[model samples]
Target: MTKPLTDQVVLVTGGGRGLGAAIATAFAREGARVAINYLKNKGKAEALAKDLGPNALAIKCDVRATDNVASMVREVTETLGAPTTLVHNALADYSFNGDGRDDLKTLTPDHLTSQFETAAIGGLNTIKAVRPGMEEAGFGRIITIGSNLVQNPVVPYHDYTAAKSALLALTRTAAVELGPLGITVNMVSGGLLRTTDASAGTPEAVFDMIADNTPLRRVTTPAEAADSVLFFASPWGRAVTGQNLIVDGGLVFG
Candidate 1:
């Protein structure tokens, strides 16, 4: 196929499994050196790296910890080269249970804080870690994985949705500030990805409902979501930034 990302180093946080893994593999397939960052899944990360061949590196990092993020970036830069594309796909805690999806009446500070820490703060830390290299190269692509729950608010994942909304705002703000440096920030928001560990706890009825409602009549796959992210990183999207591309099979149209 095409090697648009040839000689480029791409870091994907939380890339051991699920959506992150898909994105990492996609980057590697396109000829970018891939750094797969995982907080706990070292085995899986290493496996993915090996599968991706010589250009892939696996690094353990908790994005919530700025020091860890910095070190992870340093290692990747030293080993793989300076990262021109950073995909902030790390999530601290992800649960699909009904308990965490309560409305405002039942929302707790802990719930809000945890979500923000993972989705917003984690993204900020990852970006900060790689930004200097991107600046020096005069090119960068920051693609944050978001959720369609932020737009439609279907099942009341209040804290999660709110955190993603904050991330989207950060994406826009970063785009504006980094545009002068030829860096672009964007978000790819997907809905109810099917068969991932993160969605294992979701009720079957919920999945059924979403599939029925979505125009495509099916839940998304991690691979499908990864395509949107690849678009942002590709040369085709050089002039596109500060935008959220909803890839929910046309679930939320506006």
Candidate 2:
């Protein structure tokens, strides 16, 4: 296989499992040295790193904290070389069960704040840490993981959806701000991936409903969603910035 990302170092936040893990694996397959960051799940992260060979490193990082994110980026730079690609796939601590109990009235400020802190603020922190190194190299690719719920708010994952909506806005602004430095910012918004830990609690009926509604007539997989991230990281997406590429099997077209 041709290695398009040869000699590049990529960092993926929340990369121990689920969509994040898949994204890390994809980058590794493309010959990029990968730093897989996980808040917990050290065993899984280490195992993935071992599986991906010498070029993959597993580090624990809580994106919700700026200090942790900065430390992780520093470690990556010192050990694996400065990261030219960053995939912000972290999510706030929240379950995916859309029980309809968290509407505008029932949702608490804590919930919203926590969500924004991780998805939006964390993204900003990561971008800031990586941008300087990328600028020094004159090349960068920053991909933020968003959700299709932002486009079609039918699902009542209020906190998650709202956080991702804000994340999309941040992505656009960052793209404009970082464009002059040869860095590109983009978003990959995917629908409910079937077997991720985040989606394990979702009701079966709700999953079925989403599958039925999707033009593809099936729920998406973590691998499928990860492919979209890889696209943004690839040379093909060099000119694509400040755009949200929805990867929901045509479920929510915008």
Candidate 3:
């Protein structure tokens, strides 16, 4: 029995845990060889690769560094074949506790720069490294994990939201250029996820409030958001590019 993504190879950054892990799992389940990229979570990444069987590999690399990203892509290509799909899901260390976050008054340029370095610059590094391979293969899928907060900003996670907003601009611009080479770049943004490492610090009451406001009456899960990523990589999204799919159960419609 042939699977939809049989023979496909996918590289997911920050894939050791949380939503990255979920997205990697989804791709592996779809019969694609998966490479899980992580910065400091080796144990979790290795465990996931083991659980996902021979089709998965965990590689460590900081996406913020161009050399690191390029090296990681080389390793993935050598081990799993050149990745035809790339998911830029790596995020900087951030806690969702509103009390812990820097508000506009206290937020400094360093804080914003750190987020931009990880979310936007990191994305560029990875894309540049793997794009050549995708061009050679004449097929590619680039899915960026974003936040619905970029549009809603209900919580005003200023730095995080601002970084994602920059990512959206990059996504759209890349889509325009890559679409001609069989590469489709798109984004999947979700509201405060039920429980990701970044969102774990969020208050339970906050989650309930978001759920109450959503049409589905529930906060979206990492797995649910991950499925939307599959759509961009699947044949169904062959013609779709430069699109942002909000997967927060109808919380923010665009």
TM-score winner: 3
Model 1 misplaced stretches (Cα beyond 4 Å): 1-3, 103-106
TM-score of each: 0.95, 0.95, 0.97
The 10 consecutive residues of candidate 3 with the worst lDDT sum are: 1-10
Highest lDDT scorer: 3
In angstroms, how far off is 7's CA in candidate 2?
A: 2.7
lDDT of 1 by residue, 81-125 (tens): 989999998876777866545678877899889989988999999
TM-score of 2: 0.95
lDDT of each: 0.88, 0.89, 0.92
Ranking by TM-score: 3, 2, 1
Better of 1 and 2 by lDDT: 2
What's the true lDDT of residue 192 in model 1? 81
Superposed on all Cα atoms, the candidates' RMSDs to the truth, in angstroms, are 2.2, 2.1, 1.9
Candidate 2: what lDDT? 0.89
Off by over 4 Å in 2: 1-3
lDDT score at residue 63, model 3, on the 0-100 scale: 96
Q: What's the lDDT for residue 184 in model 2?
A: 89
